[model samples]
Target: MAPNRWLRPEVYPLFAATGVAVGICGLSLFRHITINPEVRVNKENRAAGILENFAEGEKYKEHFLRKFVRNKSPEIMPSVNGFFTDPSRN
Candidate 1:
């Protein structure tokens, strides 16, 4: 409960003084309370963000498919000769 909210002008200074004291003590104990002022997203870079996500997805897809193919039949998977002809895995 805020004392000033319920108390009058003469009583307000007392409350304010006490508040500053308590705040200083609390801040001393937990001094790491700082703002995380991160930059907001830019609307103009949306297309670039989309492209980055798409490219990342493409990378994962290729890696996954390649690994699957290599695992199914390493000898015929294409890591040696074909290196890119495993039909059933991808």
Candidate 2:
């Protein structure tokens, strides 16, 4: 009965603080690994079988945004681009 009373108001802040601290640490670690090319190039950071192949290892951590944008057609606005380039538009 008495033990249950300790679980009320004061513990919420402690839980919130712990969650925030964990989020901050996770974000910091991610940023550290991402922006630091030295970390990216480290052999240990790469996938297991790819350790000997630097170029293949790079594919493992290549940013999702870069992968999405790669080899895409250069049209900034497809309809407008077509309007300018199409001989029929003239």
Candidate 3:
């Protein structure tokens, strides 16, 4: 009995290539659909000017701690006092 047309060796590579191409396109589409445009833009803007807006080392440290670290842990709140202290004397 003869093998089916799709089962032929020549057709197998074509099918494999098409399957790989479709998988790549599907993954690209999924990533675009899942990302939030506003968040992406905000991240880009922050990367561009994050340091320029907070030139002082202390201000930048305080802003980061307040935004990300303070709410993350109860134990950190007490030790965070050191972050606000005047660094010139230290």
Candidate 4:
């Protein structure tokens, strides 16, 4: 389309207004969808449940970890010495 022949000057502001209105509506929908407190609590509860079950399980906390500490003295992997540690050391 040629700029002076195909494009109408009056339609430019209409297009800009429509674009802005769509952007504002999208942002409003996104805010309502993301900042829901109930959904946040639900997500947090799921994460907390997983961590609690895995790290604080009675079998792991009381038995497996203790045996692992006794068997692997420093409990440090040669490749990841700084990254991993047995809770017994602390």
Using all chains and alpha carbons, the TM-scores for the candidates as numbered come to 0.28, 0.38, 0.37, 0.35
Candidate 4 lDDT? 0.59
Evaluated at residue 87, the lDDT of candidate 3 is 90
At residue 52, what lDDT does model 3 achieve?
34
Q: Pick the candidate with the highest lDDT.
A: 2
Clashes of 3: 0
CA error at residue 76 for candidate 1, angstroms: 84
What lDDT score belongs to each candidate, Candidate 1 first?
0.56, 0.74, 0.60, 0.59
Model 3: lDDT of residue 80: 65
- Please identify which of the two predictions, 1 or 3, would achieve the higher lDDT against the true structure: 3
Query: Compared with the true structure, what per-residue lDDT tens digits does model 4 show for residues 1-90?
Result: 577664698878988999999999998677555653333345556575434244434543365457757856474465366445545545
- Output the worst ten-in-a-row residue range by lDDT, candidate 1: 31-40
Pairs clashing within candidate 4: none
The numbered model that scores best in TM-score is 2
lDDT of 2: 0.74
Let me know the TM-score candidate 1 reaches against the reference structure.
Answer: 0.28
Ranking by lDDT: 2, 3, 4, 1
Candidate 2, 1-88: lDDT as tens digits = 9877767888889989999999999997987677644455566665443235666458655868679989888778988889888998
lDDT of 3 by residue, 1-90 (tens): 356855888898898999999999998677555552322345565476433333444443465447876656466465566567759547
Candidate 1 lDDT score at position 75? 62
